[model samples]
Target: MNKLMILTGEPLTRSILANFFDGISDFCVEGSFEDVPGLLSAVQNSQVDVLFADAEYAMQGNFLPLINPYGAKRPLIVLLARDGQAAAKSYEMQNVIDYVIKPSTPERLFLSLQKIRMQLSLINSYEAVGAPHSPRRDYVFIKVNKKMVKLSLDEILYVESVKDYIKIVTEKKSFLVYNTLTNFTASLPEGRFARIHRSYTVSVDKIDAIEGNTVEIMTTRLPFSRKYIAENQLKVFK
Candidate 1:
C-alpha cells in the first residue's frame, strides 16, 4: 500500500482529501495537517509516498523543497486547485507532482491518481531495464516534400495543425507533413511528446516557458487544449 500525507490550510480541504482516498485499498492517508511545520515533521519521520497539498501553501513558501529533496526519492506532491488555469500556472513555477482542481469529482481524482501511478510504474520499469549506452529512442524521421530530414528527438519545438495537415516545428525550421496531429503523434515517441492542444504535439524538452494554457516553444507560443490538459501533469518534462 502507498502511504500518503496531505497538507492543506482549510479544514474542508483536508476532509475532502481524506474522503477522496478513503476507499482506495492500496492507498493510505497517514495523516493530514493544516500547517507546514507539522507536515514537515510527519514527512521527516514517516514513510510517506505522496503529498496532496494546496497551492496556497506552496505559494506561501512552505516546506515544499523538503518534499522533493535532492530531486530524487521525492514524494509525489499533488497540488489542489479550483481550476486548470491556476493549477497550470502554479505547476509552471512550482515542483508539485500534479494538480487536482477543486470541485473535482471523484472520477477526476481517481483518473489523476491512476495517471500518477502509471508514471511511477513506467519510471520503475525504465530503471530496471538499465540505462542504455545508446541514445534515447525518442525521435523519428519523416519524408517531407521528397526530402528526408533527420530531426533530433529533443529539438522538436512544437506542432501546429493546418486544416488537414500538421506542421512540425523544430529548433531550426518548420516542416509541413501530410498527416493528422493524432496520426503523427502515434509515430513519435510516447512520454517525450505530449498532445497539449488538439492541433499540437509538443516536445516536452523544448518548452521554454508556460503561461496559463499557453506554452512558449522558443519564440512560438502554442495553446494547450482542455482535452490534453491531463498530459500536462505527466512529468514528461524535467
Candidate 2:
C-alpha cells in the first residue's frame, strides 16, 4: 500500500481527500495536517510515497523547500490551486515530479496516484530483472556564488564556453559556472545532447532551424565546427 500525506489548510478539502481514498485497498492516508511545520517534520520522519499540498498554504508562508534541494530527488505530487500561478512557478523551479490544479475531482486524483504507482512498479521490476540503472542526465548540482542549485536537464537549451567558464542557457535564465565546456559536455547524456562546436553543446530538440554551418536555437545562431558539421548534416538529411 502507498502511504499518502496531505497538507492542506481547508478542513473540507482534507475530509474530501480522506473519503476519496477510503475505499482504495492499496492506499493508506498516513497523515493529514493543517500545520506546515508539523507536516515537514512528519514527511522527513515517515516513509511517505506521495504528498498532496495546498498552494494557498505557501501564500500564507508555508513552503515545501525540500522538493528541489541541492541534489535531492523530487517527490510524487504537488497539488496546487489553479489560481495559484506564483506557487506553481515556485514548484516548477524546484522540479517537482507532478503538479495538479485544484479543485480536482476524485477521478483525476486517482489517475495521478495510479501513474505514480505504475512508475514505481516499473522501476522495481527493472531492479528485479538486474537492469542497470544509468544515472539521470538531468540530475546535476551547480554551485553559484556560494549557493547550490539543481537544474533539470530539460530546462537547458545550450551550453557555451567562455574562457575558463561555461555559460548554461535555459529557457527562463542563464548562469555561468566555473567549468570548461568539455567538463560540462561529459555530464550530458549521449545522443540527445551533442557538441557541435568547440564552444557550443546544444540540445537537439532545441534546434529551431539549421542554416549552412549554423544551427538556430531561438534567436541565437550557434555555429557547428568542422568535426560535427558532417554528423549534423547526416542528421538533417535523415
Candidate 3:
C-alpha cells in the first residue's frame, strides 16, 4: 500500500482529508498535521509515498524544498491551495503530482488519490524500463492523407480514439487516421505502449500527467471514455 500524509492548518480540513482516505484500497493515511514542525524530517524518516498539504501553510513553514531534499524515494505532493494562482507557484517544485483548490470536497480528495496511485505506478514502470534515450524499436511508416509518413516510434506520445477515428499525437504534431484504437495498439511494438485507459494507448515515456480518466502528454490532455473504467486491466497500476 502507498503511505499518504496530509499537512494543512485547518482542523476540519485535516479531518475531512483523513476520513476521505479510509475507503481507498491502495492507500493508507499515516498521519495528518496542522503544523509543519518536523514535516520534512517525518517524510524522509517514514516511507511516505504521497503527501497532501495546503500551499499557504507549506510556504509559511518554509517548506520550499519539501520536494525531497533528503532524496529518499522522493515522495509525491498534492498541494491544496486557496486558488489557481497559489497553485501556479508549485510548478517550480519537483515531485508535485497535482493540486486541489481549497474547500474541496471529500470526493475530490478521493479522486486525486486515485489519480496519484495510477501516476506513481506509471513512474515505477518508467524507472524499471530504463531511461528514455535507451534503445527502442525502429520507427514505423504509416499512410496519412494518401501520403506515406515516416514516424519515429519514440516521437509518438500517445494515440487517442475519438468516435470512429484514431488520433496519433507526437511531440510536434497530431495526425488523424481512420483506425481503431485496438488496431493501433496492436501494431505497436510489444510492451512499448500501455493502454492507460480504453481509448488511450500512451507511450509510457511521454506521459506528462495522469488525472482521473484524463492522461496528459505534452500540452495536450486527452480524456478516455470513463464507461470502460471497469474493464481497465492496467498491470502497472496493479
lDDT of each structure? 0.70, 0.68, 0.69
Prediction 3 global C-alpha lDDT: 0.69
Candidate that scores best on lDDT: 1
Scored by Cα lDDT, where does model 1 land? 0.70
Q: Order of all candidates by lDDT, from best down to worst?
A: 1, 3, 2
Ranking by TM-score: 1, 3, 2
Pairs with steric clashes in candidate 3:
none
Model 1 sits at a Cα RMSD from the real structure of 14.5
Clashes of each: 1, 0, 0
Question: What lDDT is reached at residue 144 by model 2?
Answer: 60
lDDT of 3 by residue, 85-162 (tens): 897664334456678888889778778877687878865775677457556645654546533366788999888888
Q: Where is model 1 more than 4 Å wrong at Cα?
A: 93-97, 130-238
lDDT of 2 by residue, 1-238 (tens): 7788788877877887888888888889989998787787777777666677776664443254442232232345556566656555434322234456667678877777777677557546644654355544444666465334767788889999987568899989998865557656765676667789999999887888988788899999988788987765554444
Question: Candidate 2 clashing pairs?
Answer: none
Given candidate 1, what's the lDDT at residue 173?
A: 78
The better candidate by lDDT, 2 or 3, is: 3
TM-score of each: 0.51, 0.49, 0.50
The runs of at least 3 residues in candidate 3 whose Cα sits more than 4 Å from the true structure, single-residue gaps closed, are 64-67, 70-73, 130-238
Better of 1 and 2 by TM-score: 1
